[model samples]
Target chain A: MLHEPATPVGKDLAATYKMRLGVLMFLFYSLFYAGFVAINLLNPLLMEVTILPGLNLATVYGFALILVALIEALAYDLFCRRKEQTLNNTQNTQGEGN
Target chain B: MTIIIFLFFVLLVIGLSLYLGKKAKTSSGYYAAGGKIHWGVNGIAFAGDYLSAASFLGICGMIATVGYDGFLYSIGYLAGWIVALFVVAEPLKRLGKYTFTDAIDSKYNSRGIKLAAAISTLVVSVCYLIPQMVGAGVLVEPLLGIPHGWGVVMVGAIVITIVATAGMTSTTYVQFLKGGLLILFSTVLVVAVCVRGLTTQPDQGGNVPYYEYTTLAAVNESGQIKVSDAGWQVVELQDIESAKLTFAKLAKDGKETWWLVSEKDGAVELHETQSVVTTRDGQRLINGAPASQDNQLRQVSNIEKLRGASDASTGSVSPIELLAAVSDKDTQINLWKEAALTDKDGGKVTIYYQKVTPGNQVMRPGLKFKVQGTPLERADFLSLMLALFLGTAALPHILIRYYTVPNPASARKSTIVAIAAIGFFYILTLFMGLGAMINGVLNPADSNMAAPLLARSFGNILFAVISAIAFATVLGTVSGLIVAASGAVAHDLLDRFLNLRMDDHQKVRAGKISAFVIGGLAIVLGILYKGMNVTFLVGLAFAVAASANLPSIVMLLFWKKTTAKGITASIIMGIVSSLVLILLSPDLFKLYGLDPATAPIPLSNPGIVSIPLSFCTLVVVSLLTGEKAKALKLAAQQ
Candidate 1:
């Protein structure tokens, strides 16, 4: 019946930054994802509409999702590294001042 | 020659494992590769670890057999990596030492957390193992020309050795090789598919039983349609405009089979194609004769018409052009759909008949998923997608890979790499599946062989190499699962409960023993769950993982009031509820020789219910026990 976090996990300097970015990305992606499922459920005929030569909305939207995931991953990684670098620099300056 | 190549790959993996076995002498080295793997190598290894037989064989097979619904599985699977990347990857690396259980239990030195998380890991790992084992069996049939049962046993034996000897080190390398080759060869195959282009009639199986379908000129008035010649009777025409098939009885032959009923311009045409049948006396018959090599079910995904292409071929068409050709209104793909019935002699007859489907229909959502069906079907689709998305972050095997990297940053970097690799591979699945569909390489008896068979359709050497890589795909995933399970047993459960002082060597010995046992169990389950769709089976595993482990992991990280009891309770509840719902599902009901319609549970997947239940249970239990746990914690510290 232990109640506390087994580790001093929240004390990490980057914990808050990581959590905020992660949650924001998660919510944003999930919202975009909902439209895919919603179309398949509500009006599936909409998926059959041929937007590109032989490709319909279903195929187009599906490919877009996979493509978006890779773009988002690369974006997330880039953003995290930049923030980490800034944090490291700030910590060094503070350490020298102290 | 194929055997030589296959054996070479097998021996290479084994030799590598035995060589690396020296490093696994210690527990840390055995469990997490001594935390020395480079991030770049680990990234491809992550792809190797994540893209199991389910991704390579199952999704491709699904797409080939049922059309676009298989692509839906790929989409959902890739979507899951996002959750893994954004939420769990870095924190899991920061906290975990060996197993995923280690991460969750780091804050609480409580026996409850150890027991619960360990059990959850074992459950999810085994559930995941079944599909890979099943996929192994399916691929082995075409790979080594062995029976399905032997294939499962062979995989179990090899993977057990992999896990028991070098543990994580060899497993990681095996996965990296598999991931790299799978993507490379798949790209080559897609290129081959594009260059070969689409053909209307793919006589790849040496023209086996190519029955010329006779179109009957039928004059119909009102609801009932009749034919004066050959004693053919259509009881009801039933909207030939939209229907893919219609029923017809031939009075002359009295054969029980469906006729291809479609509307042409303003007239209705009835056509007959070759059928393979099996009688109650165990007679295998094709076109009402004893089935032989010359008259058996051929490589079947044949296109009836190659619209927008010249000379019945669209040679060297680009990917887009190929898709466009298939989507043409005049384009038709001939697929074999099987059905069973009792004949006039009161004996059973299984019939595989031809059904001509439009290319546009093949690329849409309604083939397998029934998107236009009732609310239940829609709910099932949503449930599957939800489970897939949430489940990736919670999988014990995937979580353990986070520990293989040097630091949290490496873990983050490797995860993005995995995303790039896996996402790219899944995109290739759409082409491979469609390629198999048009090129005539699909095996109707087992859809799991679609990807391998697609290679076989083009070249023998290509098939052999692809099959070996696919076999290694199973080896890699099974290796990871066994490692995770062994860690749960040895590091989390046995170490805590035994309370016996054991060194690294002794602990490693315990882990190897558990890996062997879990591998044996996986083989048995793989054999039992034969004929079921591998992707669907993997989907069920995802549901179980998302329900059982995810709520606990997410709650532990975010909810400060999460008690040891609450975590334990949630894990147990999630496991129990999901298993119970699955057991009562229509699919399992059919498995038990009962009518699927009679199953108590309406939903096919348990995630939508069991996941929320797990979360609610955690919150309520944590609330109720917060003060009690606080007092106990203070007392223990004092």
Candidate 2:
């Protein structure tokens, strides 16, 4: 008991904001991915239906999972930076509050 | 030409690594690139490190062989990064100094945590390494006209040099370059496939040109099979009663092969113009002849009939048009299947036979994973998806990459970039695999050769370029793995757990030594697991990582009452349970030359069970130890 049990401080002013947003985006993407897997498991025949010209549900859904991950990642990054900027600006306006 | 390109790439990586090695004198420099890597560069490097031979070779080969089931891997692998970007990247960067163990053990600094995490890292890395080493050998066979053992050793040597010299810095650059070139060349190859469009006859002007299977009419009178064609004769025939399907074993010209048996208007039809038979006496037989340039497994995949096309080929079409053409009901494509049986003389015979499948069927599921087959089969598919979706963030090599970036934001930025690059590359895998499926370039015995061989179908130069990138893909990934493994050994096991009190200089030296040892071990294991499928091996690695590390990482970050003992115990449980379950699973049972039906566990993938087991273990242990830990913490604070 001579030393402090090093506890992980995973939350901070910005970290709390980031983690909340990150989990939300992650859950949204997770559901989208799960839906793709669910369709394959439950009704694989549905994957055969043509959803676009020259494209079926299987190919379209597969591509969408990948594209959505990319879009979500970019969007997540943009949102985090904007929110962090506001946090920094607010803290600066009320200097030495802590 | 392949050898020249391959050598140039290898030498360039080594030369650059040696140049960068001078700057990597400190522990941070060697292990985490001194936390100075640019987000843009690190992003592609992430792709380079992540997209191993499994992504390029195995997935393409799977798609070429099994269709849409292969793209499912692409989906799961890319989806896993969402967890990394959102949950792991920033937090891991803020906490860890070097190694995945560092991040997980940052709060506890317990010997138990160090030991468990370090062992898990080694297990996952070695599992991931076997496939890369095997893929390196597979790629090198065509590159240097060599056997697999030497190719594995050569790759090991190259990757070791990359790791031993410049460390993470050199590895990052190599990965970045490989990642960029791999994407660029794949796009080029995909465009070429689109431009070439749907062709009934592929390998247009090759020495061994592709032709559709010739179905011969025969009268099955008792045991004698009399064929209408004079050149090809079925000397002896025996019907196979398996899977409720009809197949006949035929012996002709001292070679054995399997034929699809069907009756048209009462006359038995023997289909398949080509089949490769590997005999008991170590002879490779193709179409009842010794395997040679002239006599080989006929270029396997080709369109028997193009869908809605008026000509012999659908002249230059768009990528969408290509997919549409392949997805048509009228489109008939040639695919291959393997069958095995005991010969008349008691020797085991393996035969690869051609099958005619509708384009619509070839583009859908039910080929590989069997999603709708049975409850267990569906569970296996779901387990694999869960592992892949969770495994990316849990992998030690991936976690360590966050340490290479300067800040948490940089880590997040790099991961987003990795998602874009890797997602684009995975989409191209579908195009490349579809092209290979119809282009008649896939090796009958090895689906892993699909992408490089598909590039070969385009032209020799593209093949050479793609082959070089594949080799570099192996190198980049293997180096990253070695770096992770070395950090675990030198930093976690020796320095942290063993309390060796190694200085920064001593630690870097020990890390280099560990890299050499791991490289040597990898080469030996690669040679041992020579015939294993790369994708399957990588999947097992993912399962282990997900089961072992993900729970501990997630709970440690989220749960307020999580203790060191809880983290340590769960990691061991995860590793042991997953390994045991994998050992008893049907897939490994089949690999062991035993009846898969005899496997104790029905599930081939254990993530569905083992991951939850790990989480339960963590929660139980944490609750049991919460009071003592709380008292100790309170005492220390007071």
Candidate 3:
């Protein structure tokens, strides 16, 4: 079983990169969610406006938020996969050189 | 027939449990499924574990009754998973062994951390268990014609068996099966709702509605009946339940009495009933008559006309059209009004009222949250939203799932999959809730029945399928909670804290024993909290989690200066403060038959307050004991 963490510097590099990306996505998504809540609290009547022929602002905004979440998840995965691959290549070359 | 189907589902679950039990011999196998669960299956299992009775029943009911407010929970819950994915998942997988306590205690061998984390896990688990058990009990009465307590015990027994026998292995499979089934059936229901199209009135199949609408502002007290609005003097209260109800007894102002008196669009209107029946066989009766074998319940539909539509009915509108139709300000919908009315002697009687609201108003947030409500109400709304947003990553059951996957990468992948599955299911809830709302299927007595009842409107077969899935939802969640709780007891308290030198076999045995005890405690509490809304209870569980667990997890991972003393102090402070705030909140006061105004805490959700306090406690304590931080480095090296 793996006892300690693998290569403190390597883990830290990935962790820092991932945390920055994650925090950005989290904050962005949170702001989007909070916007909806703010509308409800400040000017609920705005929700009644027709955003589409059959859809209102509230319904449109709600579904839009769900879409954003799915998009963000996909983005995070792709970016992290790339970062991990780059780290692996550097470590492999270093091992071969040694 | 419902009993047979329900039994079949239950038996299938148990069979899977026993089959999986064979693989879970070791403590790791029993507690964390040997840390070998495939990311895809574990991802679905995460959904199964997270999407408890609250997601399935409570959200649907809330949407059915209140429209858009219910879906807010879905947004918050799914949002929380983002935090888990980005923040906790990989680190938790990398660090933790048997339990969440293992992760927090990775840097320190402190007894205080073990005790505090274990106690917090227990508290959160028990609080979470109540809702699932309550939801199970709610399902039994309608599905099996049994009392609520039997349903609670039934679920408790099944979950205990699942935990005690196979532990995480059985739990993962059970969760996977139910999770897939829940999404599948919910999709089927949503499709049915779409295909049925938008209609002003549900097709009654020529049968008349049981109770008539009445405009008479009549008072029924003991044997005296008075219609003050019509200037009618007090008369003998007619026993409508026993005797045949006649128009003559209810007539005033030369108008025959309408059976239902409704307040719609700020105007009180009278409505007439088409049919009423009384049954003696304990079989469910629709509008005073016993239901047919296949057609058991009457479908509820919106009574008011659709905005800009030619007539009272639209032949068949698409899903998008349905949303548009309801969003039209000209559209009128009948929203349920349930209030607890106390009589002169302080006896509480729940009165069911139907408020006909405009579509514009129904589709907004103020219905339950109330912008115009008291300051306490607004605070409660903000607090609940805060709790749901922060609580998802903090839940004991949810956090434990991270330990099931083998590696950090797998953990992250599984979380992404869970988000996809859970997010899709929540979107479906909007349609299901609306389907129930407009169909006239809501049981005013219990809104939690909205989803299953909506399924019944289509056919008894669909009803049985949905109810069984709901029952499975409860089982999957309760078992996950028990496993987490048991892990805390055996790994953290017994072995780590008390210095019990148990081998692998003995450790697994200890977990099973604790599972049994916790399951029993859950059953009793579930019975005690019967009839409460499952989703509301879940919100409280989330508040406790965010307040007590999240700070410790987040600070330990990111804050380099964090000491063992800080983590322990923060957890204790968070748990005690949040629990006390919740107990003294207006919601609890109301539950205890006291006026809500009597509660000491103004805000019901403590996350808004307690979470920050916990973070501050940790930071301050860590600064004071910075020298001890060197110990964490040594422990990490070992």
Q: For candidate 3, what is the DockQ-based docking class?
A: acceptable
Chain A accuracy as TM-score for every candidate: 0.75, 0.76, 0.76
The native-contact fractions of the candidates, in order shown, are: 0.49, 0.49, 0.31
Instruction: State the DockQ, from 0 to 1, for candidate 3.
Output: 0.32
lDDT of 2 by residue, A5-97 (tens): 112222235778888899899889889988988998999888888889978888888888998899999888888887766675643321111
Per-model TM-score on C-alpha atoms = 0.90, 0.94, 0.87
Give all candidates' CA lDDT scores. Answer: 0.80, 0.85, 0.79
- Judged by DockQ cut-offs, is candidate 1 incorrect, acceptable, medium or high? acceptable
For model 3, residues B1-638, the per-residue Cα lDDT tens digits are 77788899999999999999999999889888887888899999999998899999999999888888898888788888888887888887767887778888888877899899999999999999999999999999879888999999999999998889899999999999999999999999888877777666565322335332445555444534545576543222222332233221234444322244434454433343322222233344333334475544333436465784424766666778777777788888877554433223232223344567888887767777775577667667777877888899899888888777766767788888898999999889998988888777787767899999888877888899999999999999999999999999997888888888889899999999999999999999999999888998898899999989899999988888888889999999889989999999888898898987888898877887888898999999888878555667788899
Candidate 3 regions with alpha-carbon error over 4 angstroms: A1-13, A89-98, B204-212, B216-301, B308-311, B342-348, B372-376, B627-638
Off by over 4 Å in 1: A1-12, A89-98, B205-278, B292-295, B307-311, B630-638
Q: Say what the interface RMSD of candidate 3 is.
A: 6.0
Candidate 3 chain B superposition, TM-score = 0.87
Which should have the higher TM-score, number 2 or number 3? Answer: 2
Model 1: lDDT of residue B463: 85
Model 3 chain B is weakest, by summed lDDT over 10 consecutive residues, at B234-243
Interface RMSD values for the candidates, listed in order?
6.3, 6.2, 6.0
- Model 1 Cα shift for residue A1 (angstroms): 19
lDDT measured at residue B186 in model 3 versus the true structure, 0 to 100: 94
